[model samples]
Target chain A: MTLLSFFNYWVVIILMMVGFYCVIARGNMVKKIMGLNLFQTSVFILFVSAGKIVGGSTPILRDGVEVYSNPLPHVIVLTAIVVGVAITAVGLALAVRIQEAYGTIEDDHLRDDFDEEDD
Target chain B: MSPNELFDLLILALLIVCALAIARTKDLAAAVILFSVYSFALCLLWVHRGAPDVAMTEAAVGAGVTAVLFFYTLTRTGRREK
Candidate 1:
């Protein structure tokens, strides 16, 4: 593979790992959502990267440029962005409710609070 | 290998390290910050992949909106050990 292509792939892989790590390691509910957002963002990167052509131009109607980057990926990413925003809104709402009910957002703390209630 | 490839490898290694740190961190705030970094890295990835629009959206939604939401939630809740 060319140097650029290799580089692009590496970036996507790295971001994916970081994002996954955030979701799994954080005790705060909000942090987990942040991690989830990162993970999804990485996926978006992957899709866009996949659509790239080394010599392609923008997918606009033009006279001379014969090669153009895939427009499908652009459309997909736009939709994904909207979806990501909606999910973030929902996640925030849930976090708000969780805070109201338990008075804490930390996973460990929330678990303990629940345990106390159970007892 | 080319210099670009080496740089890519270095960045990938850094990303892995950051991800592991995020997973291992005990502090919720730290985790959130790490997650934001991850999103930024992903945005870079999108740019590298030649999709500036996707990268832009990722930066705006993933790094900006999501981080704000998480921070707001974190602040609203108490941090005292239960």
Candidate 2:
């Protein structure tokens, strides 16, 4: 069997690991958020790709067009994208407040700030 | 391999490169910009896969709204990682 048979899944897995590593390894809060975004986007890609069929037509119905791709994933991803935006907004707001409190968004500095506050 | 398969692989390669760039950048602003490029690539991948609706959502939310929101927050919170 050729690698193409399963390489698409491998791509998504690599993205997942990259994002997960960024979230765990990065000290910057914004980088962490972007990592989360990348992770989520990879999953979205996986889902949308799963819904594709070889030689499938676009979901739109028209004359002489058959074998339409799955529309369910599209609908699901639409809602998911909105939720992701909401989550990002809230996360950023929290980051802003954290910045105001500690004057830095670095995880290391935040720890230092917390320790200093305990004095 | 057909042209379609080759194009898909090309986009996949670009996505991986962009993801690494975003993850490796120390500057938060640069990472955010790279992320916009990443999202645009993702939208293209989806469009290539025959999912225009998902592609549209990815473009609008991922590239447009997310980038703007990050910039707005960055301007207030400052841009450096440390």
Candidate 3:
């Protein structure tokens, strides 16, 4: 396929990489969570866009509407978005707790704290 | 290309830009706001792609609830990346 045909997928790939980089490169706990959110969003976009069919309308039953874009992916993405929200909530809660306990949320700082305790 | 394809391209461009900006920014609050913009762009793309239901959910959960959650956490934590 030509570049235009696969452009959407290419963008998704870039976004995934960007998110992954943020997760690995950042020491801040909240930043990592944001990165994870970006990664999940890219996946959601991938599935939803893949479900589109050229010249087709929404997956609703309407008179004189011939083709409908695949509904399954939309349904799947909907569930994924909810799951993502749950994940974000839990992750943020954990981050807050980490801050409260350690007084800092940077990964390296937390590591140093653990090292001092082990001594 | 048709208008639909052009719209898709524009939205995808916004997604890439937002993702990169979020990654690059050192300010936690700015990153969160950029992410909200990102979510809105994705929501718009979903609507244009014939998935209005998914669009609404993304708008509400992604842009609304998620940003609020992030800001709440930021208030507890600090806004600086370092």
Candidate 4:
């Protein structure tokens, strides 16, 4: 297969990089959560794309369809999606608590507060 | 390329754009909305890849419930990044 044939994987890599950057470089707690979601979705796409078969139909059985895409990856991604949402909810709840405790959700300010507490 | 390949390329392009926009936007609420758009584009890609069941779950949970959670958090924590 040519390089172009693997375009989906290339997109996944780009997306993964973007999400990684957001998580590491951003300071806003909510933005970090968004970045984590972005990263997780890219992974989901990777698995689903890997499972696709050319000239295949959906996993449902039918009269004339001879091949169906692998259903295992789809099942895995479905569970991951649900778990990802739960993670997001928990992360946001933590952000709310952080805001309540610290009065700001910016990472630098939180660090400064910690420094003050130490001294 | 055939039409199917071309369509796949288009959706992937949209996904990348949505992701970049989410990373670049300063407004937390706008980023949340962009994330929903990204999730919907992903769901479309899942459908195109012949996994309607996963696509349905993504549409309902990824684009629907998650966005609401983000919005509720935004209301509590505030919207500006700084």
Q: Write the per-residue lDDT of candidate 4 for residues B6-29, one digit (tens) a residue.
A: 888899999999999999989999
Residue A90 deviation, candidate 4, in Å? 0.6
2 versus 4: better DockQ goes to = 4
- Candidate 1 lDDT by residue in tens digits, B51-81: 6777788788778877777777667764322
Better of 1 and 2 by TM-score: 2
Question: Model 4: runs farther than 4 Å from truth?
Answer: none
Cα deviation of A25 in candidate 4 (Å)? 0.4
All candidates: DockQ? 0.44, 0.80, 0.90, 0.88
lDDT of 3 by residue, B1-82 (tens): 7777888899999999999999999999999999999999998999888999999998999999999999999999999988
lDDT of 3 by residue, A1-119 (tens): 25655998899899999999989999999999999998998898788778888878999998999998999999999988899999999999999999999999999999999999999
* Candidate that would win on lDDT: 3
lDDT of 4: 0.91
Per residue, candidate 2 scores C-alpha lDDT tens digits across A38-108 of 89888888888888887787898789987888989888888888888998999999999998877888899
**Superposed Cα deviation of residue B39, candidate 4 (Å):** 0.8
Q: For candidate 4, lDDT tens digit of each residue in A5-87?
A: 57878998999999999999999989998889889988988898888998799999879888999999999998998899889
Instruction: Point out the higher-scoring one by DockQ: 1 or 3.
Output: 3
In order of appearance, the predictions have TM-scores of: 0.74, 0.95, 0.97, 0.97
Q: For candidate 4, state the interface root-mean-square deviation in angstroms to 1 decimal.
A: 0.8
Pairs that clash in candidate 1: none
Query: Among all windows of ten consecutive residues in candidate 2 chain A, which has the lowest summed lDDT?
Result: A1-10
Descending-DockQ candidate ranking = 3, 4, 2, 1
Candidate 2 lDDT by residue in tens digits, B5-59: 8888999999999999988777778988999999999999888878898888888
Please, what are the lDDT tens digits per residue for candidate 1 over residues A3-107? 667766676677677667667866767667766765776677567767877657667676998987887988898898899889888988998898898777778
Whole-model lDDT values for every prediction: 0.71, 0.87, 0.92, 0.91
